[model samples]
Target: MTVTTDRVHVYADEFDEVSRILARTTERVRLELIDGKLRSKAVPDGDHGRIIQWLLRICMQSRPELFLHPDQGLKVQAYRHGRARPDASLASNDAFVGQGEWADPGPVLMAVEVTSYDSDTDARDRVEKPRAYAETGIPVYLLIDRDTCEVTVYSEPDGVRYESARTVPFGKTVVLPGPVDIALETEQLKDWVH
Candidate 1:
């Protein structure tokens, strides 16, 4: 298997163990297994944290029944072999109850990612995550691109990929379609981007 980082090839189970160990050892690193490759997710900066906070507040107000979960690890991709920790996961308040570090994606209504300033952000967030989430049958994948100051809503997952994608600039409003039905007023997002 081709590795994304450090040229270390490991099975899915092995990656899980390594991730668990790392989680306990340090909060400085986060790992993910996608497309049979190991990858690292950068720690969020102040702006990244603020963006998640902004979305969390809006989600709570508009859809109190659902909660925005941060740093949620999920078993994704076809057959659930791939594991990913999305920036935030939108689901019922108790969706992840009784689950371990990596939960099944069945209860997830949406997976959110805010781009970081890392070099791998383009491949990891913009390309890989959408495909992984879609293949896992998650209904929505929300991408907040800080680099370009745009929000891309991906929906209608057909098990291989999302069939529809709508992108709007920072100041406009975007609707997160069914299952995660909420209109996001993104004018505030402008303040959070670089």
Candidate 2:
């Protein structure tokens, strides 16, 4: 069900069929419906997976009150695009129950993305996804760019983009804002060779 074009025309009702078809694929791919178009990209390399696991672990260990989910699809009504899956997501433990794989972005506090393997793929994570998350009113978007070897913390969403951002290299620490008030150490994270 993956369309080859850069933009795929589809109505909101076809999401379930699209989701089912994508689940059986072997590649590390992400699909989002944007402006009545389907955007898809193969994600970062194996190192990025490790970074996601690390971030998830740290968030879970440091903030016991907040609930953390990896690869959780978000259903945001604010955009023509209806759904998105951040690499890692953090929200209130009791935000909602039984959301059935796609939860409203209203309950989300933070979304994380690690850069993908290609430049085009990296651009999607670095630019497009953050814009979508911010517009959805998610307070935090942490982008771990492997190509640049830096982690950026984007906050203060103003309905268009994050109004504030702080970036640090792999060995430095980035402080996460509210609901996840803690400094994360990036010493264990590695950079991409390319």
Candidate 3:
């Protein structure tokens, strides 16, 4: 679940400092800056980790050059002021080399987020992330919605938002479009959701 305080505005630099301190102090939580708001992301559960692993295997098999980097922090949104930690960032090997805690979203081919069973999942994963990733011009954004048991692929980013979004059930096949051209046989996704 995300803990957001709309009343208190946060700057990117302040958020960065806090995020770094959080990283150094603990591994129990992750902090994100979205729309100038400070939000905390929950640690993934066992099933969430398994789903990422499953996709990692598929990505390696299909496109050996790209690696699915888990929990990669990215600078997203307009002016690149917003910070986001995607579940998995699909990028070429060594894309994040020499970069600090948060890397530029330019090299990211796709940003992936798996929904956690939380009240804010709809607003955070479905609404906010899509806009942030798109504004950063990330080619695609993949949302694995465990709540709905569906995979939504948002692609063809037009700088403001993705022009297309295709959703498929857990047992169906979904194609992650170009830049991330891989066909996923999501039948196995059924095993990962509650």
Candidate 4:
């Protein structure tokens, strides 16, 4: 007889055994800590998923060192007792586990998050997440704007802050972290808007 093995969810109650002093708010959205502050952002739909899927597939086949994941939480000590879960995160390994419906992962080489329904939320994805990613020394951060059909890459982060930034439309695939060039059809993400 064939048997199935049980899997432990990454984002489940795994953190409960770690610390009871965690935050009280846990929404359906993504959550993370930055500079002693907690940020909770909403989830994405099909359109956003497509962009991420495209990026990951290209990235995996092109440059396999970095891993890509969406809505996976990273337990970060760099923040003021913060936990940042990005829409799409890149780990060093090819395969990853689950934390629940989400994944509580380690410090990836890079992180990605799609914009929420709010512009302010999108702006947060642009500024704060990049800042957090850089601060944590994640090295690279990518943002795909569904409403605007734009893809932005932030590199050369210095101490929880990135001094450099580049924004590109869907027409061009982005070359990131060396030897990895994948163009995002920005228009493809338009269907995911709210």
Q: Please, what is the TM-score per model? A: 0.94, 0.85, 0.95, 0.70
lDDT of each: 0.91, 0.76, 0.90, 0.61
On residues 72-130, what C-alpha lDDT tens digit does candidate 3 reach at each position?
A: 89998766499999999999999999998889878999999999987778988999899
Best by TM-score: 3
- Ordering by lDDT: 1, 3, 2, 4
Who wins the lDDT comparison?
1
After superposition, which runs of candidate 1 have C-alpha atoms over 4 Å from their true positions?
1-9
For candidate 4, the per-residue lDDT at 141 reads 80
Query: Model 4, residue 47: displacement in angstroms?
Result: 1.3
Q: Which lDDT value does model 1 have at 178?
A: 95
**Each candidate's root-mean-square deviation in Å?**
2.4, 2.6, 2.6, 9.1
For residue 8, give model 1's deviation from the true position in Å: 7.4
Backbone clashes in model 3, listed as residue pairs? none
lDDT of 2 by residue, 17-133 (tens): 776677776445677765556767566567767787777778778887777777778875365656777777888777657787677888788888877776465556777777888
For model 4, residues 26-86, the per-residue Cα lDDT tens digits are 3443444544454446666666677688778877886677677666666553534446777
What is the TM-score of candidate 4?
0.70
Write down the TM-score for model 2.
0.85
